[model samples]
Target: MQTEIIIAGFGGQGILFAGQLLAYAAMDNGLETTWIPSYGPEMRGGTANCTVIIADEEIGSPVVRNPQVAIVMNRPSLDKYEPLVKPGGLLVVNSSIIDRTPERKDIQAALVPANDIAEQLGDRRMANMVMLGAFLANLPVLSIEAIEKALQEHLPERHHKLLPKNYQALREGARYLAEKV
Candidate 1:
């Protein structure tokens, strides 16, 4: 199986980091993965986006003109990439920033209050992790155990203590979805 996901937001929102973590987790699950980040001239306050591909077979390209899933962390990202998701695909939106829903009925969408959830969990920085957890819960290609292991291996040495918090954020997201669904 192959899945293409695009994570887009303004810089400093951890959009790229979220993509990298997802790619790492996919790789840890023995899937072929590719992560392509596009900062372009928008490196500062402008829009940033990353395309991550996870497949059981070889990945042909990293560029995702139309992705199967999109994780949008801001209004611009939601407005910019919402049209690019395929039919029946998933669209995960950061509801704190984007109050509007996608106009298309072809895709399934989830509005996650990531920032608020992260803040309640005691670290606003784990907003991305919360979203990642929701993504994992919605897309079951990578197991939670594999994602936790990947997080342990991928987190920087200096931030090792944050792993448990991140894990908690993930669980919270999962629980939120469970309650909603």
Candidate 2:
């Protein structure tokens, strides 16, 4: 099976990193994957997004016109990618920063207060992990354990001290979404 996902948000919100993490997890799980990122010239505060595709066989293209899943971290991203999600697909939204819920009836949605959850966890930067966890909870394209292993192996040594919180954030995200649904 092939799954295409899009993660979008402000540049500094770890959008690209989230996509990379998914790619890494997929690869480590013996799946084929591709990660492609795009951002405005403004960088940090500008809009940023990435596309991740996971499949059991060779991938033909890196560009995805429509994705099966979308994790939007801001309202602008929600507006842009919401309609682009395939019918019956999953949408994971950062509820703490986004004021409203999704309108589509064809797709399932998980409203996660990622920023608030991460803030409570002692770092707002981990909102990406929260959102990623929420997505995994809904889709399970990659198991949480797989993701944790990928993170432990790939995250830079300098930031290893934050592993506990990050892992907590992932579990919290999954837990939060499970309850919300």
Q: What is the per-residue lDDT of model 2 for residues 1-181, given as tens digits with 9 covering 90 to 100?
A: 9999999999999999889999999999999999999999996889999999999999999999889999999999999999999999999999999988999999998899999999999999999999999999999989999989998999999989988988999999999978866
lDDT score for residue 90 of model 2: 92
Q: Give per-residue CA lDDT, model 1, range 1-181, as digits (tens).
A: 8999999888887888888988998888788999998885866677788999999999987778889999999998888889989999999888977878778898988889999999999998888888888888898778777778888999899989998998998888777777899
Q: What is the TM-score (0 to 1) of candidate 2?
A: 0.97
lDDT of each: 0.87, 0.94
- For each candidate in turn, the TM-score is 0.95, 0.97
Q: For candidate 2, what is the total of clashing residue pairs?
A: 0
| Top TM-score model | 2
- C-alpha displacement of 73 in model 2, angstroms? 0.3
Position 109, candidate 1: lDDT: 87
